[model samples]
Target: MAHLRDDSRGQLLLVAGLALALVFIGLALVVNSAIFTENLASRGETAGSSGALAARAATEANAGTAIEQANHYNPSAPVDAFNRSLRNVSTQTEALSATSGTLSNVTYAGHRNGKRVSGAIDRTNNSYTVADSVERVSGANGTRGLVFNASDLPGESTPLVVKVNDTTATGDRNSWRAQIWETTSDVHVKTFRNGTSASENRTERCSVPSSTANRIEVTAGLVNGQPCDALRRNDSGANFWFGNGAGDEYDVHFKNTNYTTGDFEMVVYSGGGPSILLTTLSDDAIYDAEVQFVYDGPDVWYNTSVRVAPGEPDA
Candidate 1:
């Protein structure tokens, strides 16, 4: 009877040990699976964040392009034309995001109205105003979309000078000026801004070969179709696209326009201005736009509002 009891006890001990071993193995598997799942979720979320940001950038860029194109197409009915163009842009961007396994959408929220002034750069002996009493878009900080196309520009002595004068500026020291001239081989863009005093004055110059391109996109900060350092940023690290230091409200004027033969254009953010030498007719245009952007992906969701203003100062 004692031997039988001992044998039974040994068998029970073996069974208990086997059950504990199996339990430990099962628990280990469950813990490892949990850790792996958590890691996967973290990685997925990181990727999703990147995708969302990329989508946002694409949407904004496309919207800006669409706005410019729309203005060119239907300047008479600016807002309606921009809406139609924006819809097409949104649809294309959405499809593009899907290819990367992300979902995205862009919708136009609204726009600001402005005037598009364009005409010849051919004035006679004296400087003249292209647009007077021009102001930035209501509530906006600056102007945008100033461009010039010219050839056979004269020398610095009687150059084609463009000025943005602060309506309230007391003297030339407060106005911003751009002097366009040509060397034998290159076209030059020189910028001047005498902030408040002579010591605060700043000037910069950039040049491109005359044979390259005839376009100088002032607000866009390009010369001969290439980026120009002088028009982009001033010595103080402030953007001087059209002219810094001049108040947001200013007058656009041309000096020695005969020195350069070309066409010029700009979008004055103000409601409307009296027709001047350069502009015979001012077209209604969309100056800027607002849009909503949305993105969704594995473990991530993003939504934001973006303002699209092409060639905007410091944009």
Candidate 2:
């Protein structure tokens, strides 16, 4: 009887030890599983952050396109038209993102009013007024989206000169000018703070070696899609933007218009109406828009505000 009791006690002790070992194994498995779940969550958050930034960029691009379309097609009520377009963009973006198990959206916040003035610079050689008494956008001190598309520019002797005259001031000392011409192998844009006399005024020049340089984005500071120092912000106090240093309002005139052959366009923000020289393709167009973007993923949520101005100069 004593030997049987000893064997029973040993078996009972072994069973307790095995049970404790099993409990320890279960705890380890639980801890490892928790660590793995945390790692997956972190990875998901990182991917969501990247997706949000990409979505914001896409929203800005789409908003810019919407503004252009509204100005060109719904000039009478561009702001209202732009908002409608934004709604469609939001719906499309959300639907596309759903395929990736995410939600993204773009919502219109607001817009700035302006006019899109476009047309031939001049069919004849006669100089004429491009716009008169055009005021700068209320908050900003300059105009935007001023571009020249010249297919046939004359030589320096008869270059096309664009002048910006202060409404309340006159003379070479108070105006900004851009003289454009082309040579056998290059196209040139000469900017003047006040007058065309290079020795008497602050002047700078930008030239492109390609004979096919036709596009000149003036306010955006690009020549033939290349950066040009003459048209951009300069610390020397001479910027070629029409409204710069021109007071509250200015008149845009083309001197020797017959020197260049092409179309030009610009947008001015003001309460005044468009000049007859400009077709006023859009009376009350939206020049820029602000949008709110949102992105939602399994492990992250992001929201941001972006302003879309397609041709505004780089800050």
Candidate 3:
């Protein structure tokens, strides 16, 4: 009986030892994950900043070439030439950076913008589609709307904001006006042409919900006009499939139909700027970019998006 009791005590001690060992192991794993996550965030920021700066450099260096090529462009036209030029610049920059300090597995997404002036690159085709964005116009006609690529906006959510400043008018335009709406399909837009009732001077704003459709349509008219009802998904003209409702890749557009004599700037934002462009992806237009970084140790990846416009710089 004494011997049996001793064995039972040994068994309990062994079980306790195993439990302690497991606790230590679990602690080590948690620490490792925390460290890796921190590394990813910090390194991702570095790669993103560097990449954005380099992209800016490349864009500046290649703008003239792109324009020169576009002057007589045909076939794939200037877009093909433009992309090639950007790729060349990105490749050179990547090589230089990697050798100097940038991360590896750093893909030179010299990925083509597919002639898109401003948009996010599709993972499927590697093309750009600008979404959840805003644009401003310096000078304009009675009708003009900036088009953004589509994204999946969460249902009944207003993750996007459109702000227009048409009040800065002079001469033949004393009355400032603005109108914003969305569309799901490519049909005739009537909000910003000939005669729209923006005769009163004011600033206009609206929140864009992800529900009701896949596209943001615009005509230049009343802020709450019948055409604007498309926001409700009740409009037969609206193609609700405009967005997938997945909470990514949602497109936002802005329209101005009454600013014919003065200057105006329309800002579309989910609440941010930079890492993007307005009309073209050249020179001063190369506003921001998304930099992808991969770390092999522990197998980690980080994608850092940076906008250089508001002064994000390396430390």
TM-scores of all candidate predictions against the true structure: 0.79, 0.71, 0.26
Cα lDDT tens digits, model 2, 260-314, are 7788877776556535355543366676677999999776899888878777754
Any idea how many clashes model 2 has?
1
Query: What C-alpha lDDT values do all the predictions have?
Result: 0.77, 0.76, 0.34
**Tens digit per residue, CA lDDT, model 3, 111-158:** 111122323322332122233322221121111223333343212122
Best-first order by lDDT? 1, 2, 3
Sorted by TM-score, highest first, which candidate order results?
1, 2, 3
Clashes of each: 0, 1, 23
| Candidate 2's TM-score | 0.71
Better of 1 and 3 by TM-score: 1
* lDDT computed for candidate 3: 0.34
Clashing residue pairs found in predicted model 1: none
Give one digit per residue, the lDDT tens place, for model 1 in 1-315.
Answer: 345588888999999999999999999999999999999988988977887887788788888888787777788787887788778877888788788777888888887776777767665646777776666664454467888877567798987888987877876867888898888888888888777779877788889877534788888888777888678875577556675777767777788876777777777665544344444656777778899998987669998999988877663
The regions of model 3 sitting more than 4 angstroms off are: 1-49, 60-65, 72-315
Using TM-score as the measure, which candidate wins? 1
